[model samples]
Target: MSAAPVIVIGSGLAGLMTALTLAPMPVVLVTAGRLGQAGSSPLAQGGVAAAIGVDDDTSLHLADTLAAGDGLCDAASAREIVGRGRDAIMALESHGVRFDRKPDGSYALGLEAAHSRHRIVHVDGDATGAGIVKALVAKVRETASITILEDCRALRLIKRDDRVVGVCLEGKGPVAARAVVLATGGAGGLYEATTTPLGNLGQGAALAGRVGARLADMEFVQFHPTALAVSAPRLPLISEAVRGEGAILINDRGERFMADQPGQELAPRDVVARAIAAEIDAGRKVYLDARAALGEGFVRRFPGIFALCQEHGIDPARMPIPVRPATHYHMGGIAADCDGRTNVPGLWAVGEAACTGLHGANRLASNSLLEAAVMGLNAGRAIASEMTAATVRLEPVSLPQMSDPAPVRAIVSRGLGILRHETGLRAAICALLPKAGHDDAAAVALAMAVAAFARCESRGSHARTDYPHKNASGTRKLFTMDEAFAFARELAASQPLSRTA
Candidate 1:
């Protein structure tokens, strides 16, 4: 008998790329919403980072990535992933993605934040994600061997013996598969203010955790410094490429707050975000001033951003754009290897959902798309080579309850914002622990709280007001759901009622 189709969950860039790379192999692509319309991939404003520039090299790119990661990046993994820049670009292009190029037919590279060189490969100016998704979605639709399931949410993994054989969909019981690949993006939606799709409530982590997969770096959530400071659940990202093009961060009093900081407006995301958060905390409104740098050219350079500004009744050429920090990315997720292999056999994770250690604590601007594509392609190849046809009787499994982040949003937002402390973290844990066993969102939030509380020093994106310095030594944290619950229970039992309340 032929091998069962591989079940790939979530239809973001990673999921789409995985299915496409699988090609003639039978595959099932499941998405919570319509393909291409769901997940954080379509909302990514910054393009992919690749060391394809004439003056740039993979070593240079790796240096910037490591620097941004603070002190915890896995050097070997970062090296291998960054070294595949050229190959990833070529692969994307072959899959119908048309990156923006200069008149000389060279890839048009844009610099962002800490990158020492100009190496961001975008498409359609500021609409990079949208453009790339449009192309890939087209390619996926035409592929003969892939079956696309729209509006289907995968709630849990169906593990038999020591391996994950398939996933239990929300309404569709257990569908058997040779392997299960989770490309379910990040957990940014747990926060009230975020740049990711609201549905991204760490579903991948929750699924993997329930099945005993290890999650690493759960506390390192990257907050973008310039999400449009609008009153919306999901803030629109202003793109770090804007700052890369010479925009400056200014307060309502017209002070260039980041001027004296290292690297200034082009500093690492953690620095910029903290600066912005400080300004907001002090009752000041921060704005991105693109007037002197881009001016009239802003419309041509960032047409999508220009349109978004116009919709909000602001003109980037004339006035500064209102900006603030918002939960932008998650550096922590289901612990996986370079090839997206989890400790659990027959299960894999990619994109923002997998902690491959390429992005240790903080992700370099635009490196997300690169990692997603690379890891997705790598996972596809690995699965194809290792998968085998086997006949196993399917056993009945109960579908998990659909997750709702609403209950845990306020707690998570307060405890795990740009700045964290023991008090807030413990309070969040105390509240989330009670609901975690039944609520997937609460379970994911509890894990993040536990991890954040355990990490005693400030490092990268995980800033702690109480512990204001980086530790002399730090390592990536790996914990299963049970371990997190055990820690939470112990902490809760020891804390006084007054303190927890």
Candidate 2:
């Protein structure tokens, strides 16, 4: 007659992995849409990064991750997550994930940008995410201990005496439990141009922030360089693997501009994104030209991207694919340790919702999937060890009503997109603070603006036009709602005139 022992508020790789790891234990898994349709997991085209190649090891993977993080990565956490990469891959394989294999019966390792070794483990070529998610969904469906709450959405976390006791759903009402795991993904959906699922509005982080949870690295959002520029709500991603396979970036003048950069098209994501942004800002069109590189094999190798291009009326084999920088991933979230334990007792966060310091400023290509699987397993085991027989207490909880997401998306796109300036950031906060009055989406946007403004210098994904140089201090930022509001108020009070007004 007791409620489920644990409740996971996501359906992505992290949520499913956590549910599977805690086998034989009753857990309720909630999703806003059908299991795999509303998250970034199924949209992942680059596959997962693991040092499973004969020529590679964890040390080299650690080095690549640290370098891409741009000095903000927690070295210990990075080492821990990357160290578990092979084991995570093996575990996924055991769960029925069929990774692409070579003729010799070995894994077909891939090369992605910022990685020195060919270590990406994929499935069906570019449909890696779909393959992995399909396998997990099938396995989870077979598990009797796990209850699926299809179309049920979590509005907020219910806390009592500084401990999270339950989550309030939008329609079904409150479901209390001994433990609440927030596996909700990133805030990229807050922006107009983004590659994340539309449901990913940072609800989990907003819920945590409302209850005074610590958030870290909220300023660092990685902008992927090759999001297809089209008039659509969901931006299709031209995978980084395309570049790794020898694609070149060209400007409107038919020039290979990336040739001047050291890494060419295979540079770190931040560099490539900025370069593409620069070209776009200079009134020159930027395109991902794989015509001479991948050629006809593009359709066979990357059927997902090829289909997306064809649907948009472009062919990668014949013409250049239009590309631009768009909000891709967030390297920041609720400040949690490697085990997904947040400061709030009885509450844990995993996946992109939890900032475990594995990704510093920018995430390396294909590492998000790896981090999700590895960290989800660790958190599941940790939560399993701390389970108790405490009775579930369901209670009536009032939730905040969020305003239309249009205004927040516009402000974020202008100020927090790829390039930022001091004046624009301050203006963005002033506009956003008033709208954040009980709106969870606006509050998440405010948190990001506050953190972005607080960090005076540019680092990795957080680029500033005014303070164009990196600060000498390599300190990480941690913030709360009060701190962010305080900074926003102070900033508004200092400015005599408001550009947003």
Candidate 3:
């Protein structure tokens, strides 16, 4: 029989790039929904951050990334990833992705929060992610070596002797493979208000954690400060690029609440999000006033965002956008190395699903795309070099129950939201522990609650009401599924269940 193919779960930028990079090596790309239509990648409004401009360099990009990471980033990993920004951009271009360019034929660059330089490479203005995904999807469709499996979900990893041998797909049974790559996106969907696709419930971390893979930095969830405040399943994102173009944050009473801050509206996302949260908490509404800065030019610069605003009966050219904080990104995930290798052999993870220490406490805007592309390419090369034609027999495994984030959403949103504390974290753990054994979403939420409970100090996106100050020295937290469950059980046993409305 022919050797089983390398299986890639999820169809976001990272998974697509990995499958493409492993050309002629045979790959089966599995996704829960239609390819390129499910994950947060296509919903991304921000562009990729790269030091490709003559005035910019990797040093400046590295500095911005580390500064945003807030001292938890692995210095060596940050340096290496930022240094390869240009290369990642080039590789994306090679795959038929074209970034926006200037009249003089130079790549047009834009600035975002916490970025020290104009290093964001966008496409179709604010439709950067859509543009990139469209191009790559076409490229992937034409690749003969890749077998696309859409509308399929990976239920669990089939492991033997600490090595992942295949995957158990829902309704499809087991498919043997030499290796498995999980690019399953993030867990922002666990929140009541989120900018990510509602289906992204940290499935990658759940799948990995169940198989004994180490998960890290699970408490750090980055909330975007400018999601269009509307009643919807998934909130519409007001790109940071809007602020990069000089918009300001204001309260309903016409007060520029962020004016006193050092960076004003361009501060790190954590700072801006907290400031906005404070306003909302005080019974005030927040807004992003773009009239003076962009005005009519807003349509020309951010056509996508302009249209989205129009859909909600707001015109960026004339009025301010009603904005509020919403869960947007997760900086913590399955702990993976630079090559996307998980602690479990033959298992790999990339994109937001893998915490490679490139994003420590928080991720700098636009760096996500760069990291996904870079790590995808690196992992592809590593996997390709280690490819073996030899096949292994896999033991039959029962399929896991389908995950439903609905049950755990309220608990996670209450405990692990913009601000966290011991009481809420413990309450969430007690609520989630029972469901976690059978529900993947609850398992992931329980892990996050455990991590949040363990972190005693506020740092980056993780703000604690009880511990408002950051520790002089901070270290990343790593835990396995067993460790997280044990911790949660211990905490539950010691403390009475606190009531959460």
Candidate 4:
């Protein structure tokens, strides 16, 4: 196995940005598919949120992000991310990302949920992710310092004592580095309906847990309230930017009803999406009626959405698009500082795998891309600052064997799935832990269960009805693999599963 100073798992914006920021350092990037194929960034339809517009600034942007986060955001991290928004935008542009511009040479910035200003910067209409990924991939290819290993999956972290030493890539075998960055994205594939990439099965968070890294807010799973109910597991996300451009949220009876609701479709994603889910559960079809709102501008402004709609046999220029809530961003992961250093000595995290607390309860739309770019760069420099050729050498590690996946899927989907109540959460803890027999799936299931148990109070995205009260402190509960497993095992023995949960 080829060893390097830095090993980054996943090639999304976070991983790419981290590698690029490192400049001349030798790094190995292992991705589950072709560099960008398994990441959701390329499928992102909205633009990145930055405080770059004329009327917008970091303060206003920070306020919007905090409000949308629903009190879970760390103020310092929020300020750090928002304050650097302009730089992140510039970095993307400098990397040759061609953003959509107005006729006068200004950015054709659009608006999104929770922002009071038009601060979203897009490219090629609605293909913001595609454009950004194109530029990032090109940069990664051009960089002689970075080694891109595709069709590789990181199965588990190799932990020697309290710190992670390296990762075991499933087929590639053990490739060790002094420092490992968990940029493997979110845990949406853990659920039945999700908008994350299929490979975003929550392994990074679980990997972090096995080595005793502090995990933050694991229960706060952001459910993107508007995933198009496609005939797939990781359902296609219907971009929220469409609603920002004058699309209206309507029920089956052709009623425009979101304005009367708290937060509206333009509200925090959880509120808007849950509202939509309520309508759907009540035997009504929830749809985004952009046909009348955006009219012909729909095609000109949202080409990606339009194309996707066409592929799905829906005419967005004329007909309303069907949508439902799907699992999106995960707010919990290996807790990191501003520089992406986790609690472990040689381990770091960036992008969706790092919980910087910038996005608390819910992530503001498009802030994800901006976070990846900003933190990826910062983590790279941070890694370089802490390491040397004398630090450690690469060790050959082997991937752990996995159990049958069918029961694993059933456990997460049915019990730990969306809308968890007390009975289901506890029962799920009981059902999944004993079967955890030394595998990646077991570790992940244990971590998920531990998070479900500790968070007795429902706050932010983690809605638990049994422990329905929201704690005022709502302090982030960090857990180790043993702590989480032990707690889950205990809870499993005590509480019985509820039918509704």
The TM-score that candidate 2 achieves is: 0.98
Candidate with better TM-score, 1 vs 2: 1
User: After superposition, which runs of candidate 3 have C-alpha atoms over 4 Å from their true positions?
Assistant: 387-389, 498-501
Scored against the true structure, residue 446 in model 3 reaches a CA lDDT of 92
Tell me the tens digit of each residue's lDDT in model 4 across 1-501: 443568888888888888888878888888888876778788888888998888888999999988877788999999998888888888888888999899999999988888899999998988888889889899889999888889878877876656677677776666667688888888876777788776676778777776778888777788887788668756877788888878888898988778797657788887786678778878999889887788888888877778878888988888889998887888888899989998888788898888999998778888998898889878887887874633445466555565665566677776564467756666667777777646666567667766866677776677776776778877776777777777876665666555655
| Clash pairs for candidate 4 | 18-376, 174-397, 423-498
Q: Give lDDT tens digits, candidate 3, residues 127-183.
A: 988988888899999999999999999988988777898998877888898789999
Count of backbone clashes for each model?
0, 0, 0, 3
The candidate 1 region of ten consecutive residues with least summed lDDT is: 492-501
lDDT of each: 0.92, 0.89, 0.92, 0.80
What shift in Å separates residue 385 of candidate 2 from its native position after superposition?
0.4
For each candidate, C-alpha RMSD in Å? 1.1, 1.3, 1.2, 2.4
Give the candidate order by descending lDDT: 3, 1, 2, 4
Residue 388's lDDT within candidate 2 is 74
